[model samples]
Target: MGNRQSVVREAARFAEWVLREVGRELRVARLIAGMTQGQVAGVLGTSISHVSRVEHGLIKGAGLVALSRHAAVVGLKPWIKLYPIVGRPLDRAQLALFAKFRDRIAGTWRVTLEAPMPIPGDLRAADALLAMPGCQCMVEIITRLADFQAQVRMAHRKQRDIGASRLILVVAGNDTNRRAVRDAGAAVRDAFPLDTRATLAALTSGVDPGADGLVLL
Candidate 1:
């Protein structure tokens, strides 16, 4: 029993170490990003003091979710840059794919195509988006597609830039996809086309849009 207690105490200490290190890294990342605590706090729904405390190794129970949100605000989002291998840089094709998305993606809503979804080909399929009753959705789709370079362009597609949104990138030929993620103003979630709602829900419960897009298909 004493030994078990000792192990438990050690585990707790390790966890705390991880949080502190993350907080330290978070502070460094924020500085490099040229973002203020207040700015980051606004995005995370927390106060400047809270961000300061977290950065100073003062947060008591900073969970993974909070850490992720803070990391994103500080621009330390995972896959922001791809290191297929340690100490390795991305190749040209890989760089172009990433740049395509980075340059093309803008506005408040961002859509990434990773996995394919089952949607109808007829106009009826877009009825939901068409029925939005305003130009907000149109602006989002335009901002989304125009942000990237694609062989296939759509005249009309449905999407939105509301927060708490995610999508999969249907990467085909060429390898510039990695750059799309690194240069994003916001987080560009690198996704496999196979990731599904069930899988996403397991990670974090949020809205994920479909990836099968076409202006006229």
Candidate 2:
């Protein structure tokens, strides 16, 4: 219910932004065509106040027909474009690195890719989940690290919500990612106490790491 309400609110905000931009464009078109609001109202068979309201994006609720007419009078065409929501695209290098990591641990741990969060109605999912006798780990794989703090917070949330015994961030061993981890320094170390070597050893041995970890892939 909360997620649905948030989506509705976001949609409303985006609609409001689009309406305001369209209104501005319409006003600009009228000015470019050397026409007055009264002239536009006359052409559209509407009142000057209605035209003014539309131009200001103050009119609301089922006004598409009126808006279309107004747009035509102002010598503007209105259309809609749709796009799919998608995650960040990984490059070939990242894909190859991820595959190698998967193969390395495939023999020891039970790995689930794109593991859904345990909470019902939650759309978010972990990059991977690894399980064995003593530990259940929620893992996030980052080929390119941006906004380190935000990523840490998101990982923490997933770990808590999924009730995993440990959280592991598998970062690509590129210079950029390495520098980012180095710059983060103590914060990274504190959040993920176990080092890459320790984390890998634990996973290979099917033992509990006993804490959160950051592994360089």
Question: What is the RMSD of candidate 2?
Answer: 13.0
Residue-by-residue lDDT tens digits, candidate 1, 1-217 = 8866875776577557756777899999999999999999999999999999999877868776787888988878632221111112334543455455334333333323221113321111111121111222221122122345331222122232221132223242323433443443233332222232332232232222333222200
Cα error, candidate 2, residue 116 (Å):
0.7
Residue-wise C-alpha lDDT for candidate 2, range 112-198, written one tens digit per residue = 776776764354677778898767899888888997888898888878877788998889988999999999999998899998888
Stretch of 10 with least lDDT, candidate 1: 124-133
Q: Candidate 2: list runs displaced more than 4 Å.
A: 1-94
TM-score per prediction, in order, is 0.36, 0.57
Would you list the clashing residue pairs of candidate 2?
none
- lDDT value for candidate 2? 0.78
